[model samples]
Target: MKSEHTETPVTVLGLGRMGSALAGALLAAGHPTTVWNRTPGKADALVARGALRADTVADAVTASDLLVVCVLDHAAVTALLQPVAGQLAGRTLVNLTSGSPEQARETAAWAAGHGIAYLDGGIMTTPEGVGLPTSMILYSGSPEALAAHRGTLAVLGDPIDLGADAGLASLYDAGLLGLMWSVFGGWLHATALVGADGVAAGTFTPVALRWLTTVGGFLDRYAGQIDAGHYPGDDATIDVQLAAVEHLLHAGRERGVDGRLPEFHRELMAKAVAEGNGGDSYARLVDAFRRP
Candidate 1:
């Protein structure tokens, strides 16, 4: 049986790991895919998988009305696509390049000037995760373009529309990456602490994951408190956490685990206590992160 979205032809410019994965997903979903890479050899595997290899950027751009570019950076995206601006008019260009929000806005403007429909994208998964429905691929700018190609794009991942702000996808991408790193750091620190007691990471991780699920519920509650500009300490107060953090510090110190991470938390909580905000919820710490 044929897939419903297979009719939209896709031109993929750039055949890096993620780009190759994107093209592979589109092809696997039965879309007619044309692929190109600066190093021509990169397209060989994709071509073998039934993707049409485009000899030049212009050929790639003209191959399909839905053009997806995943390149090294914003500069590379601009360098590759600027020359083919004439061919892109009336076509939709989806850029999955990693770049700043400012660069995304600039690219959206450039596309606008050329009459090209644009969607700035942030792929939330690594190359291996591409095409899985569980993976999220964020998109912003040109709601019409997103609406038109969403079915085809879904083959890459779950398409998350971040509204019409061209810069939002990149902004959210940066924030989400920072959150991932923070989670990784905390997990590693906890694993090391437990490892000192002869606990295997595998054994501790399942329990840690359950704890994270509980933490997620706290976040949902805290978000409401934050937005309301009120931090009720009904559940747990900063003063209580301040006292609890010292235990973590002592444990890390006794175990000879690096104490910097917990120390940072201690410092933040201590500062809030010193400022007479000890009765406030942990969400009150958001103030410490705001620009002074």
Candidate 2:
């Protein structure tokens, strides 16, 4: 039976791991995909998978009205697209390249000058996670462009629209990566502490995951406190958390485990208490992170 949805033609301008995954997802969704890579041989597997291989960037850009570029960096994106700028007018360009928010805004401006529709994107998953609906792909800029191609883009992942700011996708991407690393550091530290008592990481991780789910609830509550700039200590005060952190520090020291992670928390909590905010909610420590 023929599907009711029509496939949107897609052009992928890079064949790196992430780019190849993007093209592969589109092709799997039955979209006509044209792909090009700086190193031609990189497109071999994709070509074999029914993607049309483009001999040049220009050919790739002109192959479809919906163009996606995922290259090394912002410089590479600019270098590759500048020559094809004239051909991109009236077409939508979705850049999945990792870059700074400033670079995203700059690219958006460049696209606007050339009459090209632009969407800056941040792929929240690794190459292997590309086609999973659970994976999130954040996008900003050109709301119209996003609405127009959202169905095609959904094949890569769940599309999260951040509106027309253009720089928000990269900004949020950077913040999320920082959060991920912080979570990793805390998890590894906890795993080591438990392992010292002969607990296997495998055994401890499930418990840790449940604890994280509880922590997520705390975050949801704290987010409201943060936005309102009023953190009540009804649930848990900074003073209470500060005292609890000492146990973690002492436990780490006794186990010969690194104390740096807990030490940072201790420092933050201690400072908040010293400043007479001890009775405030732990979310009050957000002040510690603000620019002085």
After superposing candidate 2 on the true structure, give the runs of residues whose Cα lies further than 4 Å from its correct spot.
Answer: 1-5
List the candidates' TM-scores in order: 0.98, 0.98
lDDT of 2 by residue, 1-292 (tens): 4242468889999889999999999988899999999999999998998899999898899999999999999999999999989999999999999999999999999999999999999999999999999999999999999999998899999999999999999999999999999999999999999999999999999999999999999999999999999988989999889989999999999999999999999999999899999999988988999943
lDDT of 1 by residue, 1-292 (tens): 9763547999999999999999999888899999999999999999999999999899999999999999999999989999999999999999999999999999999999999999999999999999999999999999999999999999999999999999999999999999999999999999999999999999999999999999999999999999999999999999999999989999999999998988888888888999999999999999888932
Q: Compared to the true structure, candidate 2 yields what TM-score?
A: 0.98
> What TM-score number comes out for model 1?
0.98
